[model samples]
Target: MSTMTVRMNEQDAELVRKFAQFEGVTISDFARTAILEKIEDSYDLQELREAIAQDSGERFSIDEVLTELD
Candidate 1:
């Protein structure tokens, strides 16, 4: 186990506390989950970039990716 210190603006801290209460978790757990989610998102983006770098020059255009949204 490890411990760390975090400082937050009073208003932001209060909002986190309220949200944590609503979610039935401690404020610390809520913050940890939020931080972990951001880390996972960045990690996924990095992996996607690596996969693109390994591609054999074929690429999808923005239009191709967005066409399904229409």
Candidate 2:
């Protein structure tokens, strides 16, 4: 196990502490779990940014999205 230090604003640090307490975990454990969970859910950033850059705001509704899907 490795120990690392990170800096955050007081408000953000307090928020983390509150959430950790609510979840019955140490701040470190809560942060580590949150980080790992997000990484697991994420897609490659390069592909996401490329898709976003090409988006033209042309498809703005559920119907349009369904049309494209079908």
Candidate with the greatest lDDT versus the true structure: 1
lDDT of 1 by residue, 1-70 (tens): 7887788899988898899999999977988999999999999999999998998997788999899678
Clash count of each predicted structure: 0, 0
lDDT of each: 0.91, 0.88
- State TM-scores per candidate: 0.70, 0.58
Q: Pick the candidate with the highest TM-score.
A: 1
